[model samples]
Target: MSESKPGFRPAMTWLHSWAGLVLGLLLMTIWWTGTLSVFDKEIDRWMQPETRIAAPEQRISADAIVERVLTERPDGTLSSLLIYLPEERVPFYEVHAEFENAESYRGRLHPGTGEELGDEVSLAASGFLYPMHYRLHSGAVGYIAVALATFMMMVLLVTGVVIHRKIFTDFFTFRANRKSRRSTLDLHNVTGTIFLPFHFLICLSGFAIFAGWYASIPLSFVQLADPENRAVELFYAADNDAYYSREAAGEPAEMLAMAPMVAQAETIWRDRYGVEAKADRIDVTHYGDANAVVEVRRHFPSNRTEAHRDSINFDGATGAVLTNFEASPLRKTRTWLEGFHQVRFDHWPIRWLYLVAGLSGCVLIGTGFLFWAASRRRKEAAQPFKVRLVDTIAVGSITGLVLATGAFLVVNRVLPLDAAALGIERAGLEVRCFFYVWLLTFVHAAIRKQRAWMEQCRAIAVLAVSAVALNWLTTGDHLLAAIGKDLWPIVGVDLSLLSTALIAALAAGRLRSKMRQVEEAAVATHRRDMGSPSGAAGTVANRAE
Candidate 1:
């Protein structure tokens, strides 16, 4: 106060602008990948053609699938087996088995035929892009980065509203016809202000999804004396007390058929919820032993907004219900937030809306990057390298990131099932394509400067269209074929790719026009300076492209 300190609004303004600028790149990556992950399962189906079949009217039995799994591998003493039953969205049986020797097996089977699918050659969205959203595929480090970014996002949203004197007005105040810097700011304000509540909630819910990580902090201290890292295990053990398990008796027992047990569990849930309910997964422990227990878990139902995994355990031999587990109140609250963030509930309209909101987050973050670069370029005009560097990063992160994703999809379609090099499988090769293409975009942006934006947009358009065409060529599932076969997931992905191509092409054309205008202006300024005795030092070219 004695020295005339800045007011609250001014402090918030500085915080908002600087914080956003500092972590904007990370935010954009998270937001874009998160947006794509809204339909990760759909993308999975589109990428893996063997999983694109329609749901069978008459389904195979859970008992039969289990029997087949055991028959396929008779050597190892069974440790545990998981059967993921088919649903409307994913119409296939998936099995994962673990033997006492630690050998594991995974396969996808046809719903009607129960025939195991060929080996999956690709690590589609569920494996890659979805994880990239929350973890960046870097494990603990990625988790921390995303957590920090999410926290900063919430802070930015608050500071942005405080600094924006006309926050509500900004919702309808986009001036698309204004000058470049002003319109960019306006667009940023509009997106940020329009989705203020949503942005806040999404960020907040993200924290809940990672609540376990936060819990590990205190639990780690609690387990300081232990040699093993059991903080997470302890956290779950205390919170998940309802789970029931029994040790193997070592006496061989013919386990009751799992089909009846599965039906009984579904019927109980359906009766309790007054709606259709089905077992999402069945987990078995100590198979072939008297104490073996079959646990059936139901997710995405039994409740809509909790992401609750309601489970019921049945005795191995008699198939009698052992424990109908229910989560604690605190657990339910966390799960509710998890469900809200995950959007895995059974609602079609809201699912599509989540997609729109997620993309809007991408737009909000991208526009913020643009606004900062544009405003800074004017004041830092003399530092050409600095301005160009900022422009290059902006171009590479926004358009280039998206272009890399398009290339990833295209490469997935182009690579043969047996594609491998230097011991890397086809899935690993596809990941390499994504990273290498992304790295090249940065180099390309630095070389092309202002022209990079338009050039990359064109590349994105080509890659997107090529992905769709290649999907048709390789799988013979064009838009029409998918529609005829009622393969809506494939159709949805194809249409989205075409839409992306169209949008990228349009953006390319606009950038080309803007580039022409900038060059023409620079030429005029140079001509004016050439005729003067003492030439003006600065030109439009020095300021911006």
Candidate 2:
């Protein structure tokens, strides 16, 4: 067959190669991180072992937390607050408050101290990574990137299906040791094809999660009439029906006590549905003011339904009931989707499945990166600066990101808990540690050449292992302790990190060895070929003679 001949279908050939070439790594990172994000809370629990406390009445009434918050920051707009009961795995009553002249909001919390947990506000760092994968943390830019990535993902999906006409037959095909473009193609197709359903749903749902922001631009006029002001704005609007007046606001209205309120809320939920609802949070607005509404929200679950679920209403000034909205159909649907998407409500089995899927997705993307590098390596030496720049970003951002995240966990353990005394907030320090490490990795990748890739991978392996060791150092229990206590989060997260480190170390070793072998073989071939007169030249000279 003529190598130059355009025998293979042009569109299919281009789609198969370029699609994998373009989106492989990013797709992997998004999938893996997203999977991890499902259990972001669990990971946090593993990292900050100190926060775990036995179920206690340590949960202050939502009303009390609100009252305390108002006393301190009178001008700050209270957005949301919740006090999780002791039985809940992650304990923290969070207060979302917005200060004047600030475009963004902040969450405040008090760490668990056997006694009264004070309202020492801090940013929600660990929980934020879950959203950051898709939402990206970059206000407008992040969402834009997600939206674009989703669109591209859709393109890859469509092209993938089209090019692989026999996708189903090849779905289970994975040939290890085959050395040809066809084998690479098969590997790419099998991974992409088998996970097509998962990829589609995750991508679509991820985009849908932010649908209000992205899809509401053309419908701004529609939102103008709607109070919530966005597409799929199904969350029950905060009931502002409470009677409020400047003069009457300070009236002596004894707000409903939280203990009874909790009992009553749980009773109402159970009696109404014959199910025990885990009330992780309650929101009370206008604490001392006449119009206080008690909003009860459920904790995060990996389950599809009841993820973003909450029920709320206005309680009269004198602790009398005023208004309430039971979970509606639309609200229920949103909750279900959000829950599955967030994996907030997932139990152990579902979480494991998600983890495996996430890892597979990461593999898909990582392979794509390798494919690109392998294909371009010979041409890379002659490529333009722009091409080289992109290559650098690919290497740095992909591998470097993993290391940076591990480093953040390490910093969290090392940084003194008394961060305030040192004029540094723990959350700020953590964020800086993550970003700075990533920044350094990027710079290091640009200057260090191929060696940087290996070095960084080795660093990632080391940091990951060190992070696992640090857990044992900081907390005596480690995986063994978690196993004894049957704490799956700690056990799973710790072991998973350790396993990842070993896998990474093995990969680095193999890559380094392979690179060394390739270099040696190339040198040997050069010496052997050039050691004697060229056979071709000698043959021509003899013919001329």
Candidate 3:
């Protein structure tokens, strides 16, 4: 019964095992960061102390807020402005404005008093962790790498299912007390079997976010530079002309008040959808000119699971209706998918489930890496370099990655506001700290060998506790105080940090105990081998009888 002549499923098993081993670390990195991103806003509030203000009983009018912005730029000519109104996750008014004579401006404003919230001193989870999940913090190269990883993930998942024919049984099975390799594979199977659909959906939607563009249009340079496609001409003719873009009349016309137009658009959306809805953003083209137009877009209920492109264009100066845009069903389906991928809509329960499932994904990948190494360890004993390389990678990728993230959070609270030295700003310094710590973990793993895992876990515990303590010391928002002030997001972050610390400490203790047992067993074997002259010469003759 030589494994039934190694059929299609066996071939798939080979593919699944090898692919999982090679890409497992990358998938774990993406999944872990993505899990953190589920609570990104909460993390942001914890990182940026000034933004911890509770939501006002009633927010100040948007018009009044805009007035303050205009006052700040009295000397410069305003060109365009984009406003993000106060929301549940971010309890502040954020704005981006361009000036004809000055640099572009971006800032947050108080929800009640309309004062500036000042520049964010830290990149936090929203700025760095979330982007890292999608792009790995590099520009085009990172984007392409993410796309390729996502595609490979799909292949891995499908082949994994094919290899594990008893999916339902596998979902129910767990053997934590078995031999190390067997237990590791059991954990991998349970997680992969149960979260198959979720992992597949996340990957598909993520790939679609950018892959759709490549699949459909906009090889921009190719479209424009190549004589064959005339892509630029086709783009503007369709995408631009649809907006009915027009030149500024130079001779100005009195602009209509924007508040009323926004209200009207909201009302139209409410009536059309039979639900209270609000516009996501507005784009004003040719501002203050006769040909000016305002596009109010993405009028959907805040917590809607999906998205649609619902927009209305208006003659900006005269307040006359221009073109009303509603997405085609095909377009609606795609936007819905993109929105689903983002997890932007507010739902605490679903978000928690996503976090749990995402962590399970990490476990699945991590265990798969472990099982591959363990299965090959005995067979590859002759090649200690290869075996050591695999172990180093396993330790560095699993505990090492977690250790780096702990350092990142700790450093965020440790760095001072607007701190700059040697040309790196506070935010840049934070990023450098993350990569530097991450790189150090690999070096530490290679040098320390098997002991690196336990050491790194202990370090993670220390860093996690330090992050929580520093957050309290710097922001004066200890967990109990945050709870009293109804700052649940900050409280959640604090509690999560403490939990991570506890988990890391427990893992470290277990690893220490395991190492001691292995050491004791080796000592007993060495003593027995030394007690017999035959054993010494036998070791050279395979210890043969």
Candidate 4:
């Protein structure tokens, strides 16, 4: 923290720049996807039109749904089943069950008719964006990479604060009209300063969410002491002893009516906890067995303190209450940290706020890249290979990601509904299109050099517009129609696409204007050189002398 130390600020500055630049693109991708995940359910609703069923007037019977699932699934296949009751955001009954051999099934059910809803088009907001944000869908390696990036982000944030002695003053110091490098630096400083606490917490909580994965040394010691995995059990221990014991009888019996069980759980919750508890989900284990257990998880109001801890279990066959479990204080603290990072209990306003904060983080990283490139422009001209390479990567990563995401949305809407029948998995195709387009953008950037930025911006604008159009052509749900129908998810997505188009278009225009200014300046400099004696006459005079 001592500014007087020789080379302290400069060393810290170098660390900040290199650290941010090295992983900036990956961080941007993670941040962008994480931002979208704030409203992932809404995106899922927009993507999977089959899931946009209307809420039922009367609650659907869970027993009937269970029967339906049993008939559809193979005999003795279901090991466990989870039923997510319909809510305002997700209006279709969702069933997720695990099979005997580790296979899983997920499908939606019509609320009133109790019929399975077939998805012709596979939309992947939840499957793609959410996983990509956290895991990159690459399993363990991706998890390690993301964790390392998150740790680096924390380092950059701390080093950034240490170097910026005028952090408070810089919060109000944005000079937009200055030279590009200076302006970019100012913006980076301002954003980093203003949202420092948020950026720190987001990074910390993100790492903390997977703390067990990263903090394996201590966990290994704990595991060594408790070979029975009691440490793990204690970490996730339930409030009641019955949570761990449910002896299934050899004889099978039909589950008791779910309506009564649900009513009983609600009554118990309200009477005991003084909170109106509506069942958010029902999870049944040992289904059809004599000692089958049904757990009804209640939807509590969005209180960060609660940490989503409200559930009552019942005897699936007898309709008798079993156990109610609440989180321990330690577990609740972990849940609260996770809730802060994931925003699971947040409403629309707070969700949007999280999105904006996430976007600002992206901006901070982006401006850092720009500042590094712009500052080195003149010095690197003699051997500009490294600078050009970084420039291409920066362009491809920042704008290419936007372009690729827009193309992904467009592909989702443009592909035929029965794409799987045509030998192409619809969801996989969308993901492939995204990465392919992104990879091509990198090639395009390398070829086009500085023009790549403006070109990709325009490309992104076109893609955004096409996505909106394709959504309308495929779904017959234009923005105006969606608004009229009060389908805010669709409306929000459409408006957001349009806004993205406008922003990209405007950026392209400004970049073009800047390119023109650079050309004019270069032409003037050439003319001045030729008109002066320094052109050919000065060379001839020097030779004669």
* Candidate 4 lDDT by residue in tens digits, 356-463: 888888889888888777656655655558867888888987899889988888888887776753476888888888999999999999998778999999999999
lDDT of 3 by residue, 15-58 (tens): 88888878877887888898899889888988888899988887
| Alpha-carbon TM-score of each model against the true structure | 0.94, 0.78, 0.92, 0.89
lDDT by residue (14-70, candidate 2, tens digit) is 765576656554554556567677677667676566554444445555556656766
lDDT per model vs. reference: 0.84, 0.61, 0.80, 0.78
lDDT of 1 by residue, 1-545 (tens): 21255588888878887888888888998999888888888999988888888788799898888778778888877778888988767778999988989999899988898888789988898898989999999998999999999999999998887778776656799787777777888888888887788889999999998876777767777678664766667667876665778888989898899988888988888887777777889899988888899999986662376687679999988888999977778878877888888877667788888888888888888888888888777778778798788887888889989999999999999988899998999999998999999989999999987788899999999999999999999999999999999888888999999999999999899888887776677667768777652233345444342
Which runs in model 3 stand beyond 4 Å of their true positions? 1-6, 216-225, 228-244, 299-301, 531-545
Compared with the true structure, the alpha-carbon lDDT of candidate 4 equals: 0.78
lDDT of 3: 0.80
Among all candidates shown, the one with the greatest lDDT:
1
- In model 3, residue pairs whose N, Cα or C atoms come closer than 3 Å (at least 3 residues apart or on different chains), thus clashing, are none
Order by TM-score, highest first: 1, 3, 4, 2
Q: In candidate 1, residue 338 scores what lDDT?
A: 82
Candidate number with the higher TM-score (3 or 4) = 3
Off by over 4 Å in 4: 71-78, 98-104, 216-247, 267-274, 298-306, 420-424, 528-545
